[model samples]
Target: MQYIRNFCIIAHIDHGKSTLADRLLERTQTIHSRDRKNQLLDDMELERERGITIKSHAIQMEYKYKGVSYILNLIDTPGHVDFSYEVSRSIYACEGALLVVDAVKSIQAQTVSNLFLAIDRNLTIIPILNKIDLPVANKEKVTYEIMYLIGCTSEEVIYSSAKEGRGIDKILEAIICKIHPPKGNLKAPLQALIFDSFYNTFRGVEAYFKVINGQIRKGDKIKFMSSGKMYTAEEIGNLRLKHISKSIIRSGDVGYIISGIKDTLSIKVGDSFTSVNRPAKAIIAGFKKVNPMVFAGLYPEKTEDYDNLRVSIEKLHLNDASLTFFPESSIFLGSGFRCGFLGMLHLEIIQERLEREYGISVITTIPNVSYKVFLKCSPTDIFLVDNPSDMPDIFNIERLEEPYIKASIITQVNYVGAIMSLCIKKRGMIKNQYYLMPQRVELIFEMPLSEIIFNFYDRLKTISKGYASFDYSPLDYRFSDIVLVKILINHQLVDALSTLEHRSNAFYIGKKMCKKLQKIIPRQQFDISIQATIENKIIARETIKAVRKDVTAKCYGGDISRKRKLLLKQKKGKKKCSLLVK
Candidate 1:
């Protein structure tokens, strides 16, 4: 019998997936007793600093219980909305999931969304109610609430405090007893599902996968199902706790393979691998290509650092596949790459890494959304518009459907009226409201994605006084008034800085972006006007005052040669204009 166990931990952001993984690593003795570093699963610097798992990390451990040595593969997946697609891929790699619900917070929108994904994948789910050791301990009530939402029996719920190391053994014991092992042909043709990949300075590309069938050994030739590219595996290995070790990953084993494939483009996160000797047909259903909802152009502040920017992006792609980039030149920014990302946090992470790791200073354009537009007299059109210069020429786009999200707010009942008013101001339509308890209520709203792009988060905090927790997921796009808002530098429409926004929220966003850009750009030689144009008509404008120190006080010539050199220096200063686009 194949004694393999595969499972993923699903939870809301900050609900302790990483912490639970740390406990699991400790209980399994993956790390030595002396190792004191916490959150061992989140090894990345960015992941540790952000206190969230950016990518799904896997670790394998061998545990002996009841005289049987069991192999357990634990996949720590992302909990944020930006990586929801990756979360799904992680789910596919496992036969069961351990849904970690915050004992105090109960069920959240992401928790519900992840549970639905697990159900859709037909994975056996074991819901664990965490945070019992806190002062507000209501494990029984939390268990009741989870069972009510998930339709599970009260007995199926497991309560624990992952932080204090309480009930961890029960969690592990439940995995062994309740979760089922893989049911596939172990000795058949090799077919491994590559869920995640990372780059090592010494090891090239490390592709982590779950072997469904057939045996994979060192020095075997393999092919990626999606890329159709062949590569020779230098070594096939499995994670012994956190370290990758050389081992024969047979059927029903969750492991990683190191191949000579150095280029990240050849190995995609959701790609499948098959043996050259016995190639199996690829199943493309599990991997859904993540479309970047937000777009931004990253420009090197120093023109000479363009190559460094490219190198940084290339390195970033080694681990982050959701980020897409294309060579783009702007009238104001000149040569740069327009990058698309899952959301604001994803964009910030990439930008911070580019500056910190690559040692390049960059100026990024305000992010905009991709829209689907339908002309009044022509066929449907789908394209991206970041700057106003890219707007369609004189074409009457009667209607457009921008994306919106179904947002849920869980707060004290006292704050419901305030949150409801805030939602209304953001053009949100209330769908449902329910009381989890007498004091806590869940407020559901369908809100346009544009409304939450900037300071909506800050606004929420201000209104709720940090008492409200929010979660949201993408809803279907609906028809709305689409306006093309273009940002202009010195009254000239900059094609690289335009955005397609809903008519209802265009002025607010346009004004907001102008403020951000104004704060970054230095005062110019002349008063620079920042304008927002809609359909070639200027709707908003902001003035940046001229720099007072642009001109230098002259000094009398000491020598004939010195006088000529001073004139030349003055001419060069005139060429270095402060206005970005004049």
Candidate 2:
């Protein structure tokens, strides 16, 4: 335990967290020279193809410092905001964190957010300024920014390019000298924290955890404190490039346990483990499950594929424990799932993986955020709603509450005005504003989650010329005047196209939806009337003209009697082809 160092890398997107992890692995000689690769911990093919990390990977390294051998348990966390909860899980299991900042882009929104998380956990922070090898690196300014943010002296800042492996020695030395070793009582009852988990077809479920107090060995009967399910440890080992079976894992050490538990929900992230005979008295502190902010319905493209999609989704859930979903049947989409995701990007990644990894095709509806609705008859009862079609009628709804988030955005001072205007247009209120540096400013806003889940990030980047960095965390629910906007074709409502919107912007959004449907709906033998409605009143409408043939022009000038007969016949046929909503 004295030689163990558990730490994770924290940073904003594309800030060299994974690169730094690779350098650390190489410096420790954890991998063979021929196995050298970029983002080695990011084993998912999707991650390599997209050049972004979607999952957190944990690995163990053996390092020799001076005359002592050290066990370094390194967690390479995803830098994207959508996976921030994973960062929290990683931080909770570690004694220290490496705060990596890019030299060119100083400090961004997620960088500050992750820093606060580490500080809250009372973890020792090591500030690392990466990307120093680039000619355009602004090393001095970023160093000062890191120093100010961390309240650290200039000497404490480690200056090294992860790409060039310049500061690998300094980082390892800092971890050994500055970060405190894990403190645990080996004699205490067995208490382990499952920080991360995944499903395996050949070997049931694998739980990667940190032993908090007691030791665990092969063939020990362990039980999940949360689920109360007992299982024999089929295999116990340390997490190296591969699972290396160890006879036992001692306290303050990170390792993996392969139990025969096949059920996905039985093994949960943040769950506690203990010996069945001597269970811990209480669960780990601050063990709340992740709250998903974005919701969407995923229906199998073919009805017959429902069962196969179910298995695929279960495996995916085991891989991404943050994803929450339940079986639901939709009038428009049939039997499907209403899934909750961390954000829009997370939603997209899940969709792409479903196609590429599982070969399952699905139909996704308009995304929405969960809402708390109260009925007039039962005002105290809160009906949780994530689908717009699930919302109760206006007459029955006493109040509607929407989820709001505190969005942190950092950008240059010149783009502040445009950003403020755009956020205001989305019903965002300025909570605070300040300048991080002379020309770089940071703005904090309280905005509805639904407003920003779609295109807010893209628009912010466009307006800021790619200088703005955005991150958000959920806030409390607030009451708002929200209405259900329904889309109809030929007076028939399409539940898949329905959405819950604030009354102020309902009409405008409805108008846009009508125009979009007009362009998308193909022209038939008769005109199609696309309508956006609230209750029975239509707020917007558009029409797609019928594919008509000029009967009179085709007749040419053969005879007046023939032309008249043709025109009369065409008029009668037009009357027979009924006009929608006369």
User: TM-scores for all candidates?
Assistant: 0.88, 0.96
Model 1 CA RMSD to the hidden true structure, in angstroms? 5.3
The top-ranked prediction according to TM-score is 2
Report the C-alpha lDDT of model 1 over 448-514, residue by residue, as the tens digit.
8877776776788688887677777778777778777788887666776777777877888788878
Per-residue CA lDDT of candidate 2, range 363-409, in tens? 99899999999999988889799999888888888999999999999
Where does candidate 1 stray beyond 4 Å? 241-244, 380-388, 394-398, 436-439, 510-525, 544-582
Candidate 2: give the clashing pairs. Answer: none
For candidate 2, the per-residue lDDT at 171 reads: 99
CA lDDT of every candidate: 0.79, 0.90
